[model samples]
Target: MKLTKRLHSCVQLEKDGRVLVIDPGAFSEPDAGLGADALLVTHEHPDHFDEGRLRAALDANPAAALWTLRSVAERLAPAYPGRVHTVGHGDAFTAAGFDVQVHGELHAVIHPDIPRITNVGYLVEGSLFHPGDALTVPGVPVETLMVPVHAPWNKVSEVIDYLREVGPRRAIDIHDVYLADIARPIYDTALGNLGRTDHGRLAAGEATEV
Candidate 1:
């Protein structure tokens, strides 16, 4: 499969004749469409889910389905009909020929929050793991991992710990905040010599094979 990074946290994973988009957030680049088959939203947070973008994407690709946590499903299912699937922690489902396992606690930690709105990490076809803002590892075999490198609540140490646990054959960094100006150097120095590390910045419009 081929993976391409869009602005902010959006990623397009393509294989065969389909594309799967993950977290097409508000700040994503407009013309960088990948003609998605399904969209995966890990949470309803602004940076992880954007209503406007989702609408645009759906308009662009009328056949695209949306696989997301219950919190997101509740909001969109009413309008989107069969296009939305509501998943929760421990749920397992398939889309676009890949097996998907969802797990993780809500990182935002809102009080009395919708229990089903918890954070989610997807184990895709037992090959790739996309832990959308859920910094912890899910203890599954991951050939490639799309990792979030920067957030107001996360740190470098946490990211290192996660990498050690997942032990993916290759990795792509994501969810970075602008102005930190530290991810590139840190990522280069930390994973540069590792046999498994991709050792490249996952900037918008860039594509890589996995």
Candidate 2:
């Protein structure tokens, strides 16, 4: 499968001509199009999700379906009929021609005062793991790890630690803040042996193959 980062938290995964788009929201390009056969969302936050964008994508590609958590259903079910499938942590479902496993928890750090909202990540084909907004790593090893590099709560050390735990053959940093380009040199220097995307800083068009 080919995995590439799109706008913000969005990622495009292609395998055998099937495309699965994940988290096409949060600090993303308004015009970016994720040619997805299925859309996988982790949460409902603006950065991780945008109902309008999902709706627009669905409108543009009627064949695409949405695989999301129950929290999303409560909010989006009224608008999206016959297109939403709810899955929870530990659940596995097939989409985009691969056997996908759903795991991880919610983004609790967003607001220190309140409890965390429900969230989850995806393990695609048992080789690629997209943690969405969750900070937790998968129990099983993965070939490639797609993680958020820059966020309000994530630090460089935290990102590095997560990478070490996952121990993937490669790592791609996505969902990074647009202004944190200064960390590139630092991150590259620190992650000397581990893989990092060589695309121009903040540009989401480039991809590295494993």
Candidate 3:
């Protein structure tokens, strides 16, 4: 499959003429979900779920479906009906021609004062894993891991450790719309120094084979 990193946590995956988009949020391009065969949303956070863009995509692609947590599903189901499906930890299903397994239950704690919200990572095709805002380790082997390099809930050390624990063949950056160009190399170098795995940040809109 080919993976293309959109703005922030948005990722587009394509294989055999089908397209699967994950987290086409407010931070992503307005048309990030365009032409998607399926959409996977991790949570209700604005950076990960943009209602406007999602509505537009679904309207444009009548055959496309949405898979997400209950909180999101509850709000969208009325409008889309059967097209919206709810998934939680350990649930597995097929969408856009690829098998997907859900992991993690809640978003990383941003602060004790802030109530935690639902978050679920996606393990696609048993090869690529996107953990959204959490540092969830999906016990099975991961070939290409999408790491949230920068987020209010995590630090540099946490990212490095997550990569080590997952031990994927490659680590790609996600949740990086806030990273400054000056600090991008520092994070890239830190990921590269973790060991034998290939690590790099994918430029927005660029596609790389995984």
* lDDT of every model, 2 decimals: 0.74, 0.75, 0.93
Alpha-carbon shift of residue 177 in model 2 (angstroms):
2.7
Candidates arranged by TM-score, highest first: 3, 2, 1
Q: Which ten residues in a row have the lowest lDDT in candidate 3?
A: 188-197
TM-score of each: 0.86, 0.88, 0.98
Candidate 2 lDDT for residue 134: 74
Per-residue lDDT over 60-168 for candidate 1, one digit per residue giving the tens place of the 0 to 100 score: 8878788998778888888788999988778898877657888776664334544434778777767878888777577777888877776665666666667777788
Residue 196's C-alpha lDDT in candidate 2?
38
Residue 24 displacement in candidate 3 (angstroms):
0.4
Q: Highest lDDT: which candidate?
A: 3
Name the TM-score of candidate 1: 0.86
C-alpha lDDT of residue 177 in model 2:
58
Encode model 3's per-residue lDDT on 23-57: one tens digit a residue: 99999999999999999999999999999999999
* Tens-digit lDDT track of model 2 for 23-119: 8885776644356788889887888788777878778887778899888767766777878899888999988687899988777386687778888
Instruction: Give the lDDT of residue 58 in candidate 3.
Output: 94
